[model samples]
Target chain A: MFSITGLLTISGILFVAGAAALITRRNAVAALMGVELMLNAANLNFVAGWRYFWPERLDAHVAVLLVITVAAAEAAVGLAIILNLYRKFGTVDLEQIRLMRG
Target chain B: MTHAQLTALLPVILLAGTAVALLLVQAITRSHRVTAGVTLAGLAAALVAVTRALPQGATPVTALLTIDRFALLYTGLLALIGIGLTLLSFLYLAGRTRLTGAYYILFTLALAGGAVLASSAHFAAFFLGLEMISVSLFALAAYRRDDPAGIEAGMKYLVLAGVATAVLLFGAALLYARYGTMAFAALGTAIAPGAGDPLTLAGIALVVAGIGFKLTLAPFHLWAPDVYEGAPAPVTGFIATISKAAVFALLLRLFTQVHLREHPALFAIFATLAIASIFAGNLLGLRQMNLKRVLAYSSVANMGYLLIAFLAGGPAGAIAATFYLTAYLPALLGIFTLLTALSGRERDADAIADYAGLAWRRPVLAAAFTVLLLSLAGIPLTGGFIGKFYVALTGVSAALAGSPAFWALVGALVVGSVIGLYYYLRIVLAFFQRTPAGEEPAAITRRVPDAAAIVLTLSTLAVLWLGVLPGNTLTLISLLVEEWFR
Candidate 1:
């Protein structure tokens, strides 16, 4: 059911779309979600690549697992930072947070 | 596998263990002084480890870390800066702030991160090294929680850093995708004897851009002034010395191993950034009324000077870059520590007027500051002068004689430097500028920190010791320099 080609196609589309959303989304939370999506896409790519290219290589799976761990950490840190934005400025809008723009 | 391997790892081990030890000590002791003492002790121990490991020299636990002469030299310098900044933090924090325990922890971790960066050879190690350095900096920038400027600096750094991290990761991934490996050596193998595919080229550019951001070179240098202005002075000192040097060291590894010389476009891009950073850093610095911001811009321009050596990526070039950073670490810490001391409890004690008539009030401090500034300007007999002299000589020598890019680097250096001298001298003149009418209360003197005094002594010794007799240090550096380009 989880063919390599199918996984790769889905991951590629998700990644390209997620990246586009990250670049285009105006909402801060949406942008952050886009980041999450992008990260997940990378995770998908890793797993699919593992299955297709090196299915028996434990390190490939391990590397992807490590990235997931780091991604979770990144999300936690990013959300904490966004909490400050929500409290201070009463908006989760990335565009509005441009208060200190150079 | 070898003692050399284990020995090479001493600095890393000392730092990690000390961090754990100090954290435990603080949890139990609840004393900032104890924490500071522990932190200083740790850095000192690490410095000793670095020195002992040198002469006999070591490699890595694996190829992840490359503990050669270059790593030792830079790691030693980072330890010195860390120790100096940690000592300065005592005065900066003593009764003036809270979270001393956390502050010392972040300080030690940042130093360790820098140490890792100086020694890293693989992408995995480089990313970890950079994150270790950067994550702490995010907290350190906002160390003074009450100040909005502190928060602002922190946010800017975080967002910009996130962008840079993403870009760098994408770059690295592209390179890996093309080459099937992440090791610097493997990447070098992939690119050697032929041109890199565009994917690899783009990857290098992204890596360079990420590094360019970290180093605060032009177009990528937006964060320097604001961050420097907002962050506590000692944090600025860390940013100025360790962060910049470590990133450059990593960049040196990437370029030297990748045979970047074969790529004309990449070379031109770096050359352009160097030129732009020098001019923009100088030009923008002139308009700043804030002292920290002035130095921030000046440091950016100095990065341009370092880039000149780095661009060369040859024996003389690598030596020049490392040697200059060695000289820079001390004079740099000296000036900022002096500023931090002069500022008292107020943050950014950097308004131009704060320095007015400083010479009359604090002659010794004022004169020492002047010498340090003069060193930054590359004044004769100062370590900075020797560093800059080598950079210019190496840059001109390495650049293809008729290439526009080559001469552009030269022209930018000359012009930016001349323009730069004006702003640097402005503060010098302000020190002499007759107490700015109605004499605002004498710039409050915070109790001179004993740690600061020690750091100052260390930095001052380093400045003059090398300024007067640099032959020994230069010889030591050249061993790595030879290895770098060979």
Candidate 2:
């Protein structure tokens, strides 16, 4: 039986992995993917919470749906921004785009 | 929804409608003047709506939003600032860009997001509102596509803010799993004082981290200076004022409901963040030559100071924070208006040297800039002084009320202010210093736009008025905060 603790443990691992990827990755697109993974981990937690803990209440389900919608919107805007960065710097490397450091 | 609920939501709805209308207007005709005028009218209408709805009293429009006097006060304040920004942006964008209409639409949408944040009572509303603001800002930050620095700033903000949002969501999911509800009121009731469930504590910590990122509190403030330096002057102002203020409003509401004062561990966490932000901001600010980066650090320190009042915890603390925010907004916006007016075709005039001999070139602008800077530094005869005074008063009272920890925060406030003063005065001194022979002042290459001049004059007047006669505003805030607690 899939337990709430098991679900939370998986989500926790996913979150840490995503955070690690974000910190280590230099490519802008790869970093974006890391963010997506983190968001999806949160989504999974919401769905699992709904199924295992509170099937009567739809709050978790609603939260999951809204999170997905916002994540999609964020990804779209993020990719467009990355594309713009590429056009300007001719590469999407975060390290190479350091033009305004103090 | 009932009529009362609908009326209570009028201001946010009006802002969203205006954004949609602007989209249609852009499709038909792309006149910058017309677009800006429409935006100004919409903002004014929303401000009026907020004022009109205030008398109806606190209305919980569903579980998602609570349109109380506190929310109305901030919503109205945001709309007023939105109007000022629209006017300044019109001048800032007039000859600089071809697609100015889209800028106003994004601007209006961001304002809508801020309004929602000010009134949100549930996690879902909070998440949605936060994203609305972030998504709009990501686009707005990169609006100047030709500028590589702007694009980089946008990309950095996107990646960082995206992660922050996800962290916040995971936290919310944890809370929901624990309590089966995401409503602030419900969560507040569910989590008892001194409760130490590991899951709940982790969730709360993650949530704080997410918000700390937005507020640019220390340890989470890495992106602020670079983004502020790269974004357009006006957009940077939007980030400083509306974005920070709205999120802070939500933070205050959420934490107060959760009785943060009763949770010693959580209280200590916030206190640490506050102290770290103050020292980090001030020490880092002292070394920055770029004016924008200096202002960014100043903002970080200012938010830290504001958190002192928030940590004080009571009606008095709430009132002090609101008053301090009121006093801060004009000073920040006025400075950016000046920056926007000084920017030329090539790039923003953000270097400290750009202001050399401004007193000799434009005496009135220089004087206004000095007043705004003095206000920021909490010098006497400016609103910032009174705001700082109230915050210090709250901190002292909290210290006396058995929380000696507040003494440390109050001490940081004092030291931070002293360090803050040097940089603020350094900027002011630059305004008076003579330019070397054969080297022209770079800030005045463009004629000051009339709209920008008006905004500067108004901001200066507002700051001075708050400083000289703050009794009425203070009383008003106290009453609203008292109502909020009830």
Among the numbered candidates, top lDDT falls to: 2
lDDT of 2 by residue, B15-37 (tens): 99999999999888998888998
User: What is the per-residue lDDT of model 1 for residues B392-437, given as tens digits with 9 covering 90 to 100?
Assistant: 8887876665445667787788888889889989988887766544
For DockQ, the strongest prediction is 2
TM-score for chain B of all predictions: 0.95, 0.99
Q: Note the residue pairs that clash in candidate 2.
A: none
How accurate locally, in lDDT, is each candidate?
0.76, 0.90
Off by over 4 Å in 1: A1-60, A81-102, B193-196, B400-404, B436-438, B444-447
Mark the 10 consecutive residues where model 1 chain B has the least summed lDDT: B440-449
Candidate with maximal TM-score: 2
Scored against the true structure, residue B257 in model 1 reaches a CA lDDT of 83
